[model samples]
Every structure is written in structure tokens, then in C-alpha cells.
Target: MGAAPFPAGILIAAVVFHATVVLSSFPATFHLERGITANYKLKLSKLKERDRVRHGRMLQSSGVGVVDFPVQGTFDPFLVGLYYTRLQLGTPPRDFYVQIDTGSDVLWVSCGSCNGCPVNSGLHIPLNFFDPGSSPTASLISCSDQRCSLGLQSSDSVCSAQNNLCGYNFQYGDGSGTSGYYVSDLLHFDTVLGGSVMNNSSAPIVFGCSALQTGDLTKSDRAVDGIFGFGQQDMSVVSQLASQGISPRAFSHCLKGDDSGGGILVLGEIVEPNIVYTPLVPSQPHYNLNMQSISVNGQTLAIDPSVFGTSSSQGTIIDSGTTLAYLAEAAYDPFISAITSIVSPSVRPYLSKGNHCYLISSRVVLRCGALAFRKFRVKG
Candidate 1:
């Protein structure tokens, strides 16, 4: 079924908005570097004063549009959806509007002062939720915290000191913005599932934690709460899932939108036959399924990774947050040309946008060796 991918932030993320966010977060980043030797640097790109307001307005209703699609279906047990949060900053001792990221391992929210401040200066919560101020051990870490001495290589003394505060800086895509540190706190997550499809079960996991806030975009998302890092580390959220026997690789997503609330994130292996399949065995520790080759009706494109300034091999990452496949120019060109041959130029643009777009009136097929995915239209 056709589905609309992410619908957020249209215009360039504005400069005024980022200026405030950056200035507010800048101090924490500085404070962090002094106490801890920077290891995995948060590689951030200079934020271009883009049309951020346009994008923010569009994204305001991002989750609403996907709900209109008509393919109500079942998701593989390993596939699940993400719960995203958008927030603001500047206020303290309350909910700092924050951007929630699950792909990360750290479990933190904005400190009460730093957390709710970003969200309309309004932090909404139910009764059982945490009150950052009164919560246990809720205080920013000083430069002298043991986390710094042990050389934890975390966000620094700011994040490690008080066991409650951790300075942080993280980056996403090349064109995407960046965020800086605030403090640490807990977070919450909810999963859904059941039935003979017993391999998958869903429940809500609440992380009563907070994290430092940061982001270059005015509202690229709310001040970042803690990241739900899946990597190895005691503080990783995966620790929580493993306790309940939830496997990591067994995850997927169908975020079509609010109407159906999209798909499930299976914590174990799940195979779905109907949703086109590509038998990818993966290249070692990559954990990623391999894309050995791509061909149209047998003839392949002369794909050279060096030309595009990227590896020529099919080393693509499967990310839920990414709306479409973003191929390096070298790879994208030939694929577009080959696919262009299958249909009129009019339909080529959409196909170039992603692997899922319609093929128009033409028949299109993509193959990975013997396995292939073909698209055809059936009229009622």
C-alpha cells in the first residue's frame, strides 16, 4: 500500500529559533569538554538559517496525515513503531519541551527545570509521572562526579557528576541539525501486541529519567530527552528490555499515522511473507542485511561508490526515522536512469524519491539475485 513518509518541518529550520536553542545548550557542551576528554565527538554541522518555521508548521500535524491511509495490516513481531516527542526550552524546573529519540541508548529526559521549559513552558503529565524537582537524586552533576574520574566517556562531568545531570551533544543526518546537553532524568515507552503471534508481546516501559536538552532547530524536536541507545552499556535501555526477554534485532515499524497508530516493534525475530522480501544475509558485524546487488530486468547499473564519495557497495542503513532511501549521487543516478527506462519521465521523479513509490502504468521489478520485488497495478 502507498504510504506518506515523515511530514515535518518544510521550510529551512529558522535561524532565530536555533540561536536560542544553541546558546542555551552551548554552556553545557563547554562545561562537558572541560571535565571529560571528548571521545566520540558529537559531529555537528553548522546550522544553515533555513526555512525552519515552514517545516515546523508542516510537522505540527505530521502524525495526523499518515492516519488517513487505508492499509490496516499486521506487522512482523520484530517491527515496532517509535514514540516521538517534540518540545521547547528556556524555562526550567518543569517540562522542557523535548525531542524524544528511541534509537539511542541513554535513558534521560529534560530536568524538570530544563525538561518542561521547552514544551510551551507547559509540561503535561499524569499523576504517577515524576516531578523532576522532588524526585530522588535529581540534581545536575558537578565537574567532580566519579563518572568523570572513571573516565566513563559519557557526555562529560555535566552529565556524570550528580548522577542526575549529564551534558551531551549529538548529531543525526548531514543536513539535519544538532543538540547539546542539559541534565539527566527518566523516560517512558509503550509497546503493543498479543495473540498466537506469541513471539511478540507489547507493553509500556516508562523511564523515570531526564537528560540534558539540545538541538539547533527551533523545534526540530523538543529539547532532547535521553536517547534510547541500543548499544552495550549498563545505562542502555536495552538492559531494561533484556530483563523482560526482548531481543533487539527483532524490531520493525509501520508508522502510517494516528488513525491506526501504525505497526508494531517486535522484540524477537518475525517474518512476514506478504510484504515483499529480499533474502539479505548481511556482512559480518554489520547486523544489517546485505544488498549485494540491484538490477532492472537483469541489466545492472555501473555503480561506483568512489564517484559519489561513498562506498560503492550496497551498504545502506535501515532507519525508521528516514522517510526515504537517500542514495549517494553516484548510486542514485544509475538507479534513476534504469528505473526511468521502465516508465515515462513523468513517473520517474516519484520513483526516484523512494523504493516504495508507484511505478505508474509501467511494470517495474528490482532483484537481488534470484529474489525479486515486482510492482503491478490491479484495477477493480
Candidate 2:
């Protein structure tokens, strides 16, 4: 599958919550940064590499406690390989910049004793570590803990018999990995009240304190404290908070893909009059969507529905960690044919590094289906 730029609009993912709450609404919102100088090819390759690895396996309360942290990184995965946010952890909280990834479970940051963890980042952000010894509130998650059992069930963490510590080792498709033990500590943020009012708050949450990093994670380029997983597993921050009744069982985000590159992520649902709801493929490890068909310029492409079916090797996954949209070969062929047929007359279409590229004049408006591209080279 080849990569294509994400469609222009707000990207929202709202998972259904089984329980209902009757408290005052607290909407925790934050901003995200997009890397403007990241290597596009490198980002695209990483996305594909991640997809290959993914086929193998797979917020708040208060007042109804909604906690908001400042986010950094871009909405466009092509422009920036990742989007991250700063989390305040431990007592007398210290800032830790962690990648915001929806693909994997468990929130982890480098620990004081971490080895192979980059001390600097090419992203131009300061990297910090979480020291359990320094935080009086920080506690090691015992192997016998219920959370440890859950983590083991989800392939998120391991239980050591000798020390009885709950630890984790997560491997990425790009060969990057991080390993650490779980720690219960204070996670600080701003609690939003009535949407506008803000109050300081802290919650005890279980997160990984990374002791080792490997592969791309060890590189100074694009390095951060660690990753903040927004996955559906029980060990994710979302599930931890929901279990404690501090927040609802749902979360949402609106990503901006413009040059300014900022977005809003909330711990609760966004009630918009025009919002549409879609059912998620149930019991899947990843956020798999049941996509039935593809449409180009109001004309439906003649692709088989089963091409988008869920299986060990096939399924439609909505992964924010990925930089571009990937279509199965069956769907990709017709999709590219449709788009090229529409704009071929106005531009020179060719193959560049396995992607379909189009060189067009500044005045040419490249339109495919409902999407319009202008003033730049188009690649897919």
C-alpha cells in the first residue's frame, strides 16, 4: 500500500463508553505541534513499517476530572512524523514530553537509570526522565497487582518473579523499542470547568518508567521522554481514569493540518450538531473500521467490499500514529486510476520512489473526488 496525504478537516475518534455519568461537564483541551522540517519520505516509510508490524498483533472525569496538558506536534503525519504533549508527573511535577500515539498501549517515559535513551532530541525539545526515588508519591507496581495482571493479559507488561516488579517491553515496527517498569505517580493537569474555567488537579495513574531504549528510540532525532499511548487496552491512561470514576470512558481530538499546526484533544466527547457516528469493529486489538466502499468525485469505485474486511492480514485501521492513509492494493489501484484520470491532462504524472507523483503548474487545481490540492507537488 502507498501513502496519501490525509484529507483536510478535523479528525475525530470517539469510542463508545459503556457507563454513563451525571456530573458537571469538564472539557480538558490541549494544543499539538507538527514538525515542519521532518523528512517526508522517512515519515512515510515509518508509517508503512509500522503497518507491517501492526498486522502481527494489536480520559477524564470530573465535575464529570477533565485534565488538560499542553500538546506539541502536527496533525499531518507527513509534515511531522509525530505529535506529542507535555505531561507533568511525580510530586512537585516535572515536565516530560512524550509522543502521542494511538497505535499502542501503555504510557511510558524514560527513567533516571535508563540506558540507550537519547539525552537530546533533534525535534529541539528538552528530554526529561521520571525518577521514582525522587517522588515520594511514586510507587513500584507490584507483580501481584490487578493492573499488572491486566497488563500481562494485554501483552503490555511482564511480571518479574525475583523482584515482583511489573515491567514492560514494547517493540515498534521500525525496530524501535522501550522497556521499563510500571510506577504509580501523580499526573498533573488543568481541570476544565464549564468549558472555560480552569482549576489545577492531580491524579494517581500507572505509567511506565523506561529503563532502556533501542533502535530508533535511541536516536537523538525525533527523541522524546517516551510515548503516551491512547490505546483501548486496560493499561492505557484512559482506562485507568475511567476505572477510578475520575472521568468518563471516552475521549476525542480535532487535528488541524494547516501551516500553524495545532489541534485540540479532549477527555470527553465533543457535542456538535453535524457530527456523524460510525460503529467500530468490535473486539479488535486496533481501532478497526468497517469500511464498505470507496468513492471518488461522487462516483463509487468498483472495489470489493471484502477487500476492507477484518482478518489477520486485512482490515481498515484508523491509526493516528501513521503519517498517511494506506489502501489495500485492490483499493489502491482503482483509487489512483480515478485521481490520475481527473488531473492527468493538467499535470505530468510519474512514479517517484514507488509513489505516484504529479508535477503541476501553480495555476492548476488538482481535484479528485471532493479533495482539491494546489500550490504543491502531489504524492500518493
Candidate 3:
């Protein structure tokens, strides 16, 4: 089984626990990134697919908003792409599917009267718009509220001219953005109590109520209800739960490579596993890691030493939103050359635009596959 980059940093393979208490079930909704799989089986070029993946990651990483609530869900690796989970927002508790990403923070959903929001989606899930008026528990956050000011990282908080509601404008690196205001409402989800029994739970969360969207955010084939950011921060769902003593400060997710629909996400620590721990780079935005060097088949790649330097600005972030591994130009050239040189004789390499495509047997696939994952020690 191939291991991908996980921000959570632990892998608990094939462990099932029986509950003495009511176990919470936060079932994850998994789907491939755009172009990974098509229900109609339409063939897309490799370059196009790569672009779609890149675009998705750029959007996912650039999400900035204000919301907090811990959620648990698992994803299927059938398509080997992105994974998402469903969240219930509002008093009646309408379900909305959002991408499960650790690179960004804050959870925002498309609200009613949203401009450029997708009317339909290819994932076959109904994209419901949230209306604060419909939910009895929902209320608009005022500009003078402490939660609204606490969530703002900088001077980006813009209140109404009449001192009414607080507004937020979340922008991406690619110029795409979401403009909305803040709202507070109850979020419904399943919480594990003791062992086997699951309990229904609800939390009061503050999240972005998007009124307008631009650029690729408007697409239908690749659209979902919105995005859920799981990044480490005071406003993230995990931190919010820890503050309330609802759960511990640690979490884990086990994503199965097989499409068997068997995966697990635990919000608290698992005491049985004696896994070694690595220190995280402190005060960084994402799950940044100081990768020492790159090794291939017992041989380390000869590259510039500064390329792997551990710094706040120049480290690697394990992002689940990314569809494939992206290396810097200095690393990409040498890595590609080494791999292609070894397999050139056996496999006839062809190009779909600039991408190298090859046909190989099952044996070669196993030999070339690499496994990598991250583990973190969550402390209160």
C-alpha cells in the first residue's frame, strides 16, 4: 500500500475498537479530485488533469475564514485523489459536503443568494445553500462581537457602515475569492462516547456565510457545498473542541488504499500504538516538516543542500488537497531524469504534452511506489 502525505502524521492500520460508551460516528464522504474519475468515463489529457489538480490545491490552500468545530470522517482511496466529509449546518441540520483539508483553516459554506455558486455537482450530492433566516439557532455576528474580532488575523475585518454585521473577504493566490459575512449557528454531528454507542451532538460554531464566489469556485463538475479547513490554529475545529474539554488535543485518520469503504478517524489519542514521534516546526501556518534529504532505492539524490533547508518560509507542508507530489524545479529535473533513465529501456515513454506517460506491468508498479506519512504529538 502506498502512503500519501497526511498532516495528522499517524497511520493506524486495520484496528477496530468496540465501544463500552456511545461511540460517535462522523462518517467521511470520499471522492476523487477533478478528472481523477468520471462517471461518464470521458478521457481527459494528462496535462489537463494535472492542471485541474493544481488549481484545486491552490484554491484549497488559499482559503481564509472564521469557524471552529471538531469533526470526524474517513475517505476512500479508490481514485487516489482528494477526500471530503459532510457537515450539518443550521437548526434543521442540512448536510453539506466539504473538502477535508489540513493546509487551511476555517470552515465556510455557500449561503443562500450566493453568486456564482454551482447549482449542481458531478459527485451526485445535492449542493444545498444555507439560509440563516431559516435556522432558528442561526444569528448574524455583529461587527463589535469578540468572536468576530478574534477570528480576524489582520485588518481584513470589515463591518457594515451602519454597525450591523461583520463582513469577510477570503481571497486565493490565484485571484479567485469568496466574499461573505459572519454567522453563528449550531453544527450537528455524531460523537463517540465510550466504545460502541454513538451519540448525537451539536456545537455552536462561527463560520463564513459566503454570498459571492469568483473564478473556478463557480464550477459545477468539481464543486461541493464548500470547504472545511482542519489546519492547526485557535480557530480550527480541533482547537475549539480542546478548549471546551469535549475531546483531547490529538486526532488521527486512517485512509484505506482499497475502495472497501473501511476507514477510521479518531478525535482523541490512541494509547496502544508505540509510534515514534517527531517534533513539528513551531509557529508555522501548515503542518510543516524539515525533510533532511531525498533517497531513491537506497541512494540519495545529489542536489543542492539549501533546497532542503528547514526554515519557516522554506519547508514542506503535507497537504491532502494536493492530488500529486509537486517538487521544486531544482528537485524536479534530477528526480525525473533518474526515474526515466532507469525505465526507458523497458517501457516506451510517450508524452501527453509535457507529461511522461508509460505502460508498465503490475510488478513495476509495486517496485516504483513509495510510502510517506507524518505523525504529530498533540499536547494541551
* lDDT (C-alpha, whole model) for all candidates: 0.35, 0.72, 0.62
Ranking by lDDT: 2, 3, 1
Error of 1 at 37 (Å): 68
Residue 333 in candidate 2, Cα distance off native in Å: 2.0
User: For residues 174-246, could you state the per-residue lDDT of candidate 2 as single tens digits?
Assistant: 6788888999999887655444434457789999989989998898867888888888988888888778766
What TM-score would candidate 3 get against the native? 0.70
TM-score of each: 0.44, 0.75, 0.70
* Candidate 2 to truth, TM: 0.75
Off by over 4 Å in 3: 1-80, 154-156, 173-175, 196-198, 259-262, 274-276, 350-353, 359-380
Which one is best on TM-score? 2
- Stretches of candidate 1 off by over 4 Å are 1-103, 115-131, 136-165, 174-217, 220-234, 243-261, 271-287, 296-299, 304-314, 345-380
Q: Report the C-alpha lDDT of model 3 over 1-380, residue by residue, as the tens digit.
A: 13343444332222222334333554643433443223333223433334334332322211121122233222322233456667888988899988666676677899999999898986666899999999999999898888778467634457887858888787754366787888889877554433222235777877888899998779776677887766776566666666766555555555554543224344555444465766777777778777777776667889787775556446667776543455665666667667667764766555444455565653543222222221222122
lDDT value for candidate 2?
0.72
RMSD of each: 22.7, 14.5, 15.0
